[model samples]
Target: MENKNKIYIDAIKKIAGSSKLLKDEPMSRHTTFKAGGTADIYIEAENEETVKKTVDFCRLNNIDYYITGNGSNLLVSDDGFRGLILSTAALKDTLEVNGEYLTCSAGYTLAVAANKAAENGLGGMEFASGIPGSVGGAVFMNAGAYGSEIENILQSVRLLEADGTIRTADACELELSYRSSNIGALSRVILRADFKLKKGDKALISEKMAELNLKRRTKQPLDYPSAGSTFKRPDGYFAGALIEKAGLKGFSIGGAQVSEKHCGFVINKGNATSSDIFNLIKHIQKTVLINSGVELTPEIRLVGKF
Candidate 1:
């Protein structure tokens, strides 16, 4: 570590607590892919204040930093990150329900939130019951499944802007569409999300959630480590269908393989490196484009450098 970087880290430690600060933290330990190298500095931020403070500090010091929640849809490179990674993984337990609205901290997992909504007799979250990602991540990417997306239920999001100001923006302002959002381009960090739901029978909601989860378990490659659904659905075509048509299902590149169970996923078959996953994704894209004349785009966020 450089002397100047050490000085900056020390300042962060005083505000975020020594236990929250980690040096050379393994990236594999954080992401769902269970691959990659290390991050130079990692901070497990506990609340919105800590996140704002740390982000402001990083920006003011001209230090590169990335904000993450749950690390569910992320892929870091083998060479690792050269900057700070501020994570919201510690804010997973905070949630509140009022009337037809449920508000959760950014780090709260979607599965837990969906279950909690059912417990509170709220509907409209059943589609998210099996999503293995945090609330902030879902809202950031407008994540969805089973013909529903976050834009349908999302009411608003509390964000920390690049200028160090906090504001609650309505969902309509976000321009949510097909696994993309304006939040990233605007350089905003999601602190929390408010979901507007409907009152429904608890039994019916629970039953729906159970059915969806069962389908996910039966179809998805849960036995391996992966960022779910590697490719976005291209216009007029499904990415998985194209890959299958291209004869790339169950294909292997190093320990990274197109899942035998579902062509949509690229799984880490235990000894896979970040490079293996990257190469496999590219190969699938190239093959699918040539064979089907449709380009595939990755849904997972790539971090650091490949």
Candidate 2:
């Protein structure tokens, strides 16, 4: 490790426990794709306060860092990150309900939140029952499926700004659009969110979740390791249909293949590398543009050295 990293590691060890502060930790073990290299340092924050303090320390010390949650839509390069990866995933089980609203920490999984909503006889969160991400990531990307999005039900969020300040932002202030949000531009980290849902029949909510999950299992390549949809849905066009029409389904470059079951998904067939997945996605984009006359964009987030 470099001198700066060595110093920061030593400093952080004093603040956090050895178990939560890992050196050269594999990113694959934390991601849904199950493909990534080691991170120079993988640190977990117990709560929002720890996140703020850690980031503040890094900023003051000139240490590089990246914040991530759940690692669902991420694809880290083989060389790994040379900076600290501060994760809020340690706050996973923090959730509470108050009347019609369900408030949860950023690290809380979307699926778990949805289940909690259902348990409370709430309806809006049923659409997110199968989303493979956490509340923070979902809000950051305005994650949507089955015609519902986080923006639709979001009321407010507690965020940590770049300048070591914490504040609550309302849904409208977030500037949420289709699969996009202002969080990145503002350099903000979501700490928690309050979702406004309506009372509904418990049985109906459960049924909705079950129905969506069934659709996912039947249509998506859940049997394989993939970062959900490889490309964003183009306006008035479905990416999967376009790829399938281009005859690219089941296409392979190394171990990365266009899923035969779901053309939109690029799956790792046991031995795919980051380069293979990246190249396969680019190939699909070029081919789809040539055949369908519409350009495709990736929805997955890539991290670290390429």
Candidate 3:
């Protein structure tokens, strides 16, 4: 523990500015599930400069680190994370719209961006009105809904490479496909994104947003704590349909349960542990694979020591 503290202290000093860093920060507070242990080091980069500096410092020290966007689609384990957790939540910025184009920082939430677009009479992002993730995370996963996706409006993206250099890549280079992107494989950090929208009546856009939001409320289990959809959509079958068919709705393991409202979600029923969620997920997978030949993949990202 002493050695770990010393390493974290050294890394902190190497970074410039008045950046805030926390030691032994509880992961539970940083995740949507509200369950997990502690992180050895937690750093919140308030600006792009701080983000670059911190990344450089970690690289130089051979420190293991990862960036977390809104923590909406993540699950941290019980044993906790020993490395640094970099948060981009403070890097929030949205530029003025020029005609049909808008540039936004990675920290801005998708819902915020959609609202901004609607306010500006832009007509492309109404489908993202209910997405609960940051712009960077949405772009990283190519998040989509209601027959629309980030790839449809995305023009370009600014990214920080592993060696601390920033570069811009065109949308076509991202290779986005149904909740997956090249960013998932590369060790790069998304900084900002450029989106091209269409001109539309503000009232019409607002109506579309309201309709989609209402549909989300009706179909999703929003009353409980969950990391959105629990599993990825299988080839020809929906994960929720399979779970419901298996008679696993309302099934409980510890404090975790399959949401009765939406079988696609595994909710944290007040006091669920990461182990409970993990076990429940495994059981669901096994059952689904046996009952249906299609294997359900996880859309939620899990990290930390098990």
Candidate 4:
């Protein structure tokens, strides 16, 4: 709570309501991992305009800020973020549908979007029915499941650049690859996205989503707090298979443990800190490399201090 920080926070509060501004907000309360410390200043901008105003103000003032969506795939440090964290949750309040196409705000969850598409009798997004992340994060990482990724259905994305400009990038321009996208490297704020879909029976689409949801529930370690799959599926080799081969199943470092139910996930057995997970991940990588000669890359993004 420096004088300069208070001044900057006061400026940010004017862009939105006072209730939207939080100081020393607990990071554990925001992320899916249910761990970490706090954010020095957290801004919950209600709409794109507020997000733009807040970001522009920060940029102009030379104040550090990080934009995030959903916080599902992030590991925040125990020391917490020293800068402003602009969350996109408040920006998700709109969903528009036209025939076989759907457009929604970036903060909207993929699961909600998939359900909306199903309600409109739209297909091609059944794989997103169980993803627990926002549209912005999903598109950024080219997230996927069940042999399908967002690139298959994504038409374009409305990205807000750092210089206060908005640009629409097509899927081709994003260079969507296995659990990656070019936009992720650019550090732009995702505003919205258009999804190309197909006309299908609502009942059939619901059935498909239901089947996938069941598969996810049965296989994933839903009982514990985790960032979904901990490692990306390496080319020609599954990360989970390699970890299992390396004998790291149910391996524990502090309270963080490689899930016995599924080796792909690293779960908090309650009270696991950020450092615990980091050590566990490194140990798994080293063991898997020695035993299987394959390196496991983390699917989750690390933020703030370690």
Winning model by TM-score: 1
Local accuracy of candidate 3 as per-residue lDDT tens digits, 1-306: 224667467757557356668888888888888888888888777778888888887787777787888888888988878777888766775555889998889988888888999999999999987999888889988888899999999999998987789999998888888888888577778888999999999999999999999999999989888998989888888899999998899999999999999999999998999999999999999988888766889999888865
Candidate 3 runs further than 4 Å off: 1-3, 13-16
What's the true lDDT of residue 54 in model 4? 82
Candidate 2: list runs displaced more than 4 Å. 1-4
- RMSD (Cα, Å) of model 3: 1.6
Which order, best to worst by TM-score? Answer: 1, 4, 2, 3
* lDDT digits (tens) for residues 1-306 of candidate 1: 233466787898876863388889998999999998888889988878888888888888877888788788998999888888988767654698999999999888998899889999999999998998888889988999999999999999888998999999999888899999998888799888999999999999999999999999999999899999999999988888889999998999999999989999999997899999999999999999899889899999999887
Q: Which 10 residues in a row give candidate 2 its minimum summed lDDT?
A: 1-10
lDDT, residue 37, model 3: 83
Query: For residue 189, what is the lDDT in candidate 1?
Result: 91
- Give the TM-scores of the predictions, in the order they appear: 0.97, 0.96, 0.96, 0.96
lDDT of 4 by residue, 171-220 (tens): 78888888888775676788899999999999999999999999999999
The lDDT per prediction is 0.89, 0.88, 0.86, 0.88
Residue 217 of model 1 has an lDDT of: 97
What TM-score does model 2 achieve against the real structure? 0.96
| lDDT (Cα, tens digit) per residue for candidate 2, span 62-170 | 7777888899888988777777788877765458889999999998889999999999998999888899898999999899999999999999999999999999989
Best by lDDT: 1
